[model samples]
Target: MTKDFKVIDEYYEAGRKALKSYVTGFVLAIFLTLVPYFMVVNHALTAQNLVWAVVLLGVLQFLVQVVFFLHLSRNSRSHWNIIVFIFTVLIVAILVAGSLWIMYHLNYNTMSDSPFNTNEGYIPQ
Candidate 1:
């Protein structure tokens, strides 16, 4: 085949692969979203189990977006890209977890039911 034809064929193949990846990602993302939504709406799982299930599905959706949408393949050329992505994820996780921890502590400490709350709903007339 001519050089021009070869380049065109490669471009066509890449486009096909990208379209497939996007469709698959979209389907998986929808399934993940619907599963959690239904689980919550139908009370399919207990509260603790529901929370875990939703979290697991959310993580799966995140991974699907990363792999299919971001196209972060494990090719040698993209090694640095993968490393940078991992670092970003780690930093985000750390920030989220730390913030949640701080918020939980703050809420627990200041809640009306806490032992530190001495007023006990007493009112002065």
Candidate 2:
């Protein structure tokens, strides 16, 4: 029957689309991972540049995972999930930045040579 054929076609199309999506995501993830590892193993970049590269790749990998594995999208059905993910990312960024800032300041202020540090006097001048 035509109805049966239509149903089969729909399923076939859906399966093809799902397969394409997964293949694309897998390839991208593999490339992202390999590039970073190669750079690190070969010392292909300076320390600062390498760090940035790895971080950027990591972010890309995360996005790929979200889109492919988690099936997140901008569709109305997934809008709430997107919003929540963004909020969570913002909160985590703020927390990490604040913690790093505090640690840097603490280290700087507590250095042995800092005149205002109470412990500075205990060290032999």
Candidate 3:
């Protein structure tokens, strides 16, 4: 029947689109990964710039995996999954940021030149 044929065509189209999305995502992820690797391996960027570049590429790669591999989108019917994922990401980001902030302050406050370090005899001239 025509209806059956139409359904098959729709499925085929959907499959083709999914395949394209996966392929595109894969290529983009690979390119993003390689860019950072090459930059680091070749020492093309200064330390600060390299760190920023790698962070940016890592974020992009995460997005690519989420959108393509995880099949997350605004139009998805299951909103709960996306909501949970976002919540998890927020929690993780908060934890990581807090940890980094704590570590940085500790390092800055406890440096050899700091009054506390010198007073405590923790740092030798």
Candidate 4:
């Protein structure tokens, strides 16, 4: 029947689209991974800049996986998926920032340069 043929065609098209999306995601993921790896192996960037670059690439790779593999998007009918992702990102960011802040303060306060800071008084003036 013509109706059955139409349904089959739609399925075929969907399959092709999904495959293309997966391939594109794979290429992007490879690129993101290699760039950071080379940067580290070659010492192409300073420690701070390399860290930021790697982090940025990691985020991009994550996004590619989410969109292509997980099929999460604003246009999707399940709005909750995107919402949940946003919430997760927010929670993670808060945790990381809070932890870093605590660690920095702890290190700063513990390494006091006061007069009693271990053998300073005994050293030759």
Which pairs of residues have clashing backbones in candidate 3? none
lDDT digits (tens) for residues 38-108 of candidate 2: 99999999999999999999999999978876778726898888899999999999999999888666665
* Poorest 10 consecutive residues by lDDT, candidate 1: 116-125
TM-score: model 2 vs. ground truth: 0.78
lDDT of 1 by residue, 19-80 (tens): 99999999999999999999999999999999999999999999999889988983588899
Q: TM-score of model 1 relative to the true fold?
A: 0.76
The candidate scoring highest on lDDT is 1
Error of 3 at 31 (Å): 0.6
After superposition, the stretches of candidate 2 with alpha carbons farther than 4 Å from their true spots are: 1-8, 112-125
lDDT (tens digit, per residue) of candidate 3 on 36-123: 9999999999999999999999999999988887788836686988899889999999999999888666665665654554343244
The C-alpha lDDT values of all candidates are 0.85, 0.84, 0.84, 0.83
Q: Highest TM-score: which candidate?
A: 3
Could you tell me the C-alpha RMSD of candidate 1 in Å? Answer: 5.7
Worst 10 residues of 4 by lDDT: 116-125
Q: Cα RMSDs of all predictions?
A: 5.7, 5.3, 4.8, 5.9
Clashing residue pairs in candidate 1, if any?
A: none
Clashes of 4: 0
Worst 10 residues of 3 by lDDT: 116-125
